[model samples]
Target chain A: MQVQAASSSRSAQLPPNDPPGGTHRRAPEKLPRSRRRLAPYGFLLPFLIFFLAIFLVPIGYAIYISFFSTHVSGLGLGPSQTTTAFAGFSNYRQAITNPSFYQGVERVLGFGIVQVPVMLIFATILALVLDSTAARLQRFFRLAFFLPYAIPGVIAAILWSFLYLPGVSPVAGILHSLHFGTVNFLGSHSILWSIANIVTWEYTGFNMLIIYAGLQAIPQSLYEAARLDGASDFQIALRVKLPMIGSSIILTTVFSIIGTLQLFSEPEILRAVTTNISTSYTPNLLAYTAAFSENNTNLAAAIAVLLALGTFILSFGFLRLVQRRSMGVSL
Target chain B: MTLTTPKTPRPPTSEPKPVRYDAKGNRKQRWDRRSVLTTAVLFVVTVYFISPAYWLLISSSKGPSTLYNSAGFWFAKFQFGKNISGLFSYDGGIFSRWLLNTVLYAGVGAILATLLAAAAGYALAKYEFKGREAIFWTILSGVLVPGTALALPLYLLMSKVHLTNTYWSVLIPSIVSPFGVYLARIYATGSIPTEIIEAGRVDGASEFRIFRTISLRIMSPALVTIFLFQFVAIWNNFFLPLVMLSNQKLYPVTLGLYSWDNQYGQAPQLISYVVTGALVSVIPLVIAFLSLQRFWRSGLTAGSIRI
Candidate 1:
């Protein structure tokens, strides 16, 4: 209400800058009152348009289609006989019950539980080490650590697939040259972890940069104060630096969780090297298989919805947990 | 007009402290063990991180016959030129087409995404309007909604409009980056002062003109940062194109290489193409990252510091 009054009064009090000859620059205040009020909206319209088409509408459509399933009658020989009908909660039920979908979810949950912490730990360690006064060549190390992130995830998977291939693997060849026996990285038992290794390699450096940024943001005065207090460098990093960057740590953690749930490219590409990864090895892979290969769009939509909800819930739950533990730390 | 400022004021001590050495011209000796351990750990981890890429660099120079039988870490035969020709000439130069499509998608998509994001983010930062917070939060929620989750439904919607199996399917969705808006808003608030904007307003410049003429110039640094990020993102993006484009001509290099890698059973030689193509694809982005390290590092902190 106040804004409306302000805009109206501004319009009323506007100087009559419009020249009779129309040779001067006109003031924006001379524009219509409604356009003035809607100016911000005008700027936002392009982004909002695509945001609606891509984010909101798709989410709404996913929910809409999830509740519907296709039906076929009379042996389903003709397109006319097949129809999509509202399935109530049946698609959700199927998604929940299907061991394939849930198991894929389980696999990714396990992947996140193991991968996120280990990756973050590695990132935190690297960041702390680089931030340390003792570390030399900080810029060079940072670049090397971060270079893998520039490699696209699928490409990283392919690159690693070569290392995992028994024939071409230098790592395995070295292992074989040693007294230890040959190791099968693509074995069903280790394929998930092999994928995990790829994820860790691809993301650890990216996460390190975030944590490192947080480390950088810590005011140098804090370190000076800690030094004046006779705190050792290790103590300072552990006590001062770690506590200050709680929010960045949480930010990376949340993102990693989300990325973990969206694990499609690595395992999908790895399918080229090994048959161990099934079409439903991950929830996302499962959804793609359902939609494109199985021709079950409703099931795919339901699984996608479930995956999204799981991501939100897990990340939100983690945030809440950290916030409660930290008590006033915001992320 | 008197309020114009070219850059954000530099905060005190943002740079890391200069290394301190003792009278002997070595790192402080009191913590020699810690220093040695830090250096050793960093070196080892750097090696761990770099060895794969180093191997890739080495392998990209070798011939297909030498890939498996030879020392994986050491070069056997210098086949770099042959491999390049083979990579480009394979499947009637489809690899070049994929690279072009990738450039087209990522280049156009990132530019549009950055512009829209900057505009919306600027308005959010500079203006007061009803439901402003609501709109901002709605967009923020878009960040949490995973892209893979949206792929199926987005594909369905595109197909409904008979727009699937085309570049538009990938490009349209690629332009909606919620994270870009989030970054832009943070950047604008930090860098572009409102007084300069008001000065423009008093000069009778339209708001859009002020944005274009003054604000964009001020925000160019952030704009470049956003463009690089969104470009790398769209280039790295795999699943969207995987879901949207069936025609190989529309495939990004990532997807195109994946197709070749997937078909290794039928064509063993494609492995060489995939390896060489992988190396070729990453070179430009790797150089970009190394060159723009300062920009992205600052951008990351700017976007994440508040959180």
Candidate 2:
């Protein structure tokens, strides 16, 4: 996405008046030279402060804590008996070897494999349909589709959990009225997919809007040219529209991967209703359980760092693969 | 439009004139079978997206006994008012407190985040400085790091400073949105012309004054976009507040409802209150989204379209 932004900015050539040395010309003005030099940093000061405090500091602290663990002496009941000592990779080793952590990681991996593709495909289809000229009441349908995104994820989860419950769910109610066997949506086997459904419900419209915006940016002339060459609307959509918005699709997929890996809210909310979802059902959840529930902040820090590393690797690896494929196509 | 007209004149050897004209007319103004099918499909999709909320609306209106006895889709007894009153008065109006806390976090966090993003983005776009690209890339990388991944570390850090279980733990982190900065940069670059800034400089306007007086006016649309994005984001956020606040009083509506949901098994009567509370919680956001639809749409477009 940043690469795309960079290329786009380049294509949108900088105005000549806004040269690199443009600030130098302002020396003749009333503004002093030193203040002029410091002005950009001044504008950026608040964000930089917040960025360092909130983003960089936490990650750094996590890394710092990941290297240390508390050494408990006899009885270990007082502050003097406990001391923090460097454990090096022992915390990471423990986090890596934990069966529950692996289970959580595998669960998220499986969830992403199924959920991301399904969600992105649904979003792309919705976007293509909405971008079609034949689609009526575009504004109304767009808002309707997007309205779910306005609802908080926790609320969306709560609402869906109700709908999945046998007594409250219209779906369950209909099935029961039809004399069908009761299907527990929150059953152990179905809970992951139920969480997927909730996430899909929350995010599909948001992704659809991204792809639709990409489609809207495609010039009308491209469609005209395709039509002139005897392409049907379906064919035009498959060949032209899909390929043109490839980067946007990739962008959404990368985002979906990151989001899927951090699956916490939906499952956490659903955990209230059923025991099917364990505290360590997702990697983030496992980290949380470790830090707060188990009072093992070092292990939790290591798990959090590992999760962040995993996300970075997957996202960048996907981008690299896409870059190679697109490069091949251009060549 | 003119370009498409010429394509219709060519007669396809495979198809008859009527079918060709029908297809061409469908592409133009005429409503044909395809448009009908398209509308039908979209309508079904719309219903699929909206039915859960629809169910919530009607289900909340049913009384506790009728809620379990009657069908979930239809209204049993118009008990929405009673349910709402119950939801509010339950536990001494904790739900209202949660709502107020959510507004305080999301509203103030979003506003401050938007202002900071606008300033940083304007600097990156309109000004030339050393390490500008480096700063931009750092922030962009921050966007890729999921908030959930930072929850534990942030909790530890906040606890170290004795800031955990407080509003600042949530609001401070919420106010640093890298994505908002990215959006603002893209928006400012596209919307604010360099010549305007140059003209301001020539007229002896200070850099900060020019930004305040001129650039801000032109960047209003983008600023609104940033505000809405951050607002929705901060509101939807869960892991941060969940990790930070352990006190029931500090809970946002999301966390508060989750806690109530946890207790619903022991007190089945609280189910109606949860339903009503969910309904009430979403109403403000739905209203905001509907009213500010245009700004958000434009924001989405500007944020997505790389060029």
| lDDT per residue as tens, model 1, B1-307 | 1111223444533333353223224554445677778878788898889999999999998877799889999998889898999999999999999989988899999999999999999888777888999999899877788889998899999989988889898899888888888888878878787778755655566779989999888777777778888898898788899988889988999999999988877877788888999999999989988777666667777777655
Clashing pairs in 1: none
CAPRI tier of model 1: medium
Q: How does residue B198 of candidate 2 score in lDDT?
A: 64
lDDT tens readout by residue for model 1, A10-36: 556555765333447565554646765
Candidate lDDT (C-alpha), each = 0.84, 0.81
The regions of model 1 sitting more than 4 angstroms off are A1-14, A17-34, A74-80, B1-33
The alpha-carbon deviation from the true structure for residue A107 of candidate 2, after best TM-score superposition, in angstroms, is 0.9
Task: Encode model 2's per-residue lDDT on B84-137: one tens digit a residue.
Answer: 888998888888999999999999999999999999998888777789999998
